[model samples]
Target chain A: MRRAAVSTLLWAYAAVALLPLLIMVWNSFRTDQELVVEPLGLPHSPSLDAYREAWVEASFSTYFLNSVLVTTLSVLLSTAVSLLAAYALARSRSRLMAVIEQVFVSGLMMPVFLMIVPIFYLLDTIGLASTRTGLILVYSAVSIPFSVFVLATFLRQLPVDLEDAARIDGAGPLRTFWSVLLPLVRPAVATVVVFRFVPIWNDFFYPLILVRDRARYTLPVGLTTFFGEYQTSWSTLFAGLVIATLPLVVLFLVATRQIVAGLTAGMGR
Target chain B: MNRRRTAALPTPVALLFLLPAAALFAVFVLYPMATALTYSLFSWRGTAQDAFVGPANFVALFTTEPYATQLPRAFGHNALLFAGAMVVQNSVGLLLAYALHHRGRLRRLFQVLYTMPYLVSPLVVGYLWSLLLSPLFGPVNAALRAVGLDAVARPWLGDPDTALWVVVLVTAWQWVGFPLLVYGAALGALDPAIEEAAMLDGASSRQRFWHVTLPLLMPVIGTVSVLTFIFSMEAFPIPYALGGSSGSPAGATDVMSLLFYRTAFHSGASNAIGISSAVAIVLFVVIVGISVLFTQWFRRVERRLT
Candidate 1:
């Protein structure tokens, strides 16, 4: 009886956490009248019109692709950098570690809002401001500290014997990390991908200022534009929200186990 | 053959691995931060070739109308948000972790559900909460009335006194699971015998937790607290959404992030990149100083605890 009641309370707490999303999903299905009139009730009948018009008319497909492209490039770039910096921090008791760690932490203080000012100037000077490359570099730079911190933590926890054994066999530093360490810390990569990548993917502040062109607009900014253009159309806006959010939801669903591991990786040590 | 071939090229090999990140950082991060300082010195708006003003921007920013008010509010709300996150996120996380500590079946279900909020964009989180608290038909008020608590309900995001806290709560709701998951792992590593020992010595469940569990979890708490503090400081979404495009309700929740946004590309105002750059510089210095202070404080606490 106690266990059942405890589980019930836990479920209630979980439901509270999920309440807004549940409401979003529920509201997205209802008609405007239904939404306002009986907001909490199940739709008398579900309709696909919102999802359909949202996808076809609003260019949500393009926004989705833009998110995919930006997130992919950003995560790849972040992961690549993190692997090297993390490896160095993990293996070498190099005095450089202290300095580099300081750099990373300070770099975290570089607000994305502030970066817009200088980066716009820099990118314009180089003719890359509104370009995809501009957003990619900005994202990778901001994310470097986090990626390095996470990857370094994971890398430090691994046993060093395999790498040592490989080094003795004349394997180089790069080769050992690639063949041996990469597989071991795949979870860390996934964690970085989820945590770091999601920010860049759904990054509204950057894409809003940096990329003015509609063609290059990532999902977050694109959805904002969609909201302004179709300001009165709540249904379509909700639909776009659903579309903009699906990829991360998909990523999370696939990596559900890894997500837990990722957060817990820092614990105990 | 083995010895000679093995010794071939280990020096530049690892250097190649570090190249991508280092080069990107040099050109983008390092360059931009340097340029921010240089741009601060100049009065131009970062467009069209113009003459440099040389420290004029900094002087004006210090004495200017918005900067004087702007810097403090941004820093103040930034501090408040940091505090809210620490208390709400850390406490709630610790509680959930405690609930899940001995429970298994419920753990799997709750873990997945709790993590859903962190996966979405903060803007969206803000938007979703706004939807729930719309004053027009927000489900929050709806629930209040439903449960016969109508007297206690209020428009959360519209009021001055409540908007900041609403933003804080919305932001916390999004990331609390993350810290909890982190702390849960920390708790699991704690020696079960410590709690057992306390229980045998006539300690209550609360006492065991307070005396035994809490101390052991300090390091993880330090890490999660610092991470939350830094992210909350720079985070732009909660204030932007809850405060609306204008960061409104008379700029009550207009934080540094939003202020920097407004002064720059105009998060909801006019676009003046020069002044925004100056704001950015100010924000950068303040955040760095705060980060240093936080680390020092954490070090002090760690020392005392040890």
Candidate 2:
């Protein structure tokens, strides 16, 4: 009886969690008139009209490309820089290194809102404002604190025998990090990538504020504008949402275990 | 544990490794934050810095007409969001985690299902909920009317009184997966022997959970609280997506970030930069200050546990 109750509860909660997205995806294939007539009914006849409209007419293609560029570039840039910084912090024992680590760690608490206004001006001053390059830089910089924290913690906990072996093999520091230690910390790197990728991909704030040109707008911004413009066209909006969300959903489906491991690592301790 | 291995990487090489991150952080993050601080002190005339106001903007923020009222009201909404999330979201997460911990069947699938919404953008989540709760043709109202509960069907997002709470519920719906995953992991890592011993001592399952399990999970609880608090205070996308930048329905769902956005960008006020910078500074201090307090308290709790 208890087991039955538990299973039922879990299944119910699961439905609550997933039914909205399922409904949204389901209804995207239906026309807006069908939706207004029967909000809960299955699509009478599935069509790709909504998808085509969102993609071709609404310019989701451009937003999708911009999102891909910005998210990939920022994630790669931040992860690389954070890896080096994490390695330095992990391998060093000096007071200066400790202070530097603290500086980076303190950034983990720095609110983006606090820096956004100033960042706008600063980027404008440097002539990078409203540019993808500027948004990428901001994304990379904001991501540093958490990425470094996670990577450094992971690196510190690693066994030192690998580094020692590399040293005896006549490998210098860079070589050891690149060839020896880097391979071992692939999971940690993956963790950082997974965590950072979601936020940068999903972020609406920075893109909304930083980028002005419609051509350069990311998906989140584009989706909002699309919704505003097509307020009466529910199916098209749903299609746009599916387009915006499908990549992350696919990513989650593929990397569920890695993402959970990344989130839960060092969590309980 | 080898000191020699630690010392092998010379300081210069270590510094070299750190330089890129340091430079990016300094220029982009640190410099911008410092500039925000400086910007708060000056009056602005349409993006150009005017005479140094020296806290005059802050004075207007706390003492003037619209801001004076809006600041407290928005902060209150944030507080309500934090409290609501704690009560509704985290507790549900804890219960769900406990169940999933005890019942292992389809656990991996459940984890994925629960966390999927969290992985998506808050803007998307907000929009999704808005559609679900739309009174005109939303399925929720449709189902209600179908079931003969037509009176219960109303414009959820359009009502001022219910708007903020709806945002909170939607937020909880989106993020409950986070605490579930965190707490599930924590529960998994727990040593079963202690609970077993407590059971042997004539403790009920409830007693064992309260006395043995709850105390042990306090630190993780604290960490989750701090994160929830920070996120709640910094909430923007949900309210923005749901209520628009003005946090409409007569500003019922207005939040600090939205207020700041309007002040800085949309309001076209003379001192938009200065006043908005002050708002940002206040938000920064509130988040950082309360987080520090929570962290200190969590350390105390951990120390006591040990």
lDDT of 1 at A189: 83
Model 1 / residue A151 / CA error / Å: 4.5
lDDT of 1: 0.75
Fraction of native contacts (fnat) of each candidate = 0.51, 0.75
Q: Is the docking of candidate 1 incorrect, acceptable, medium or high quality?
A: acceptable
Q: Which ten residues in a row have the lowest lDDT in candidate 2 chain B?
A: B1-10
* lDDT measured at residue A21 in model 1 versus the true structure, 0 to 100: 83
Q: Quick one: best TM-score, which candidate?
A: 2
lDDT tens readout by residue for model 2, A160-230: 88888888889899999999889989988888998999999999999899999999999999988998999
lDDT at A92, model 1: 60
Model 1 scores a TM of: 0.87
- So what's the TM-score on candidate 2? 0.96
DockQ of each: 0.44, 0.71
Q: Candidate 2, which CAPRI tier?
A: medium
Model 2: which residue pairs collide?
Answer: none
Q: Please identify model 1 stretches exceeding 4 Å from their true place.
A: A1-8, A81-110, A148-185, B1-9, B45-56, B148-156, B267-274
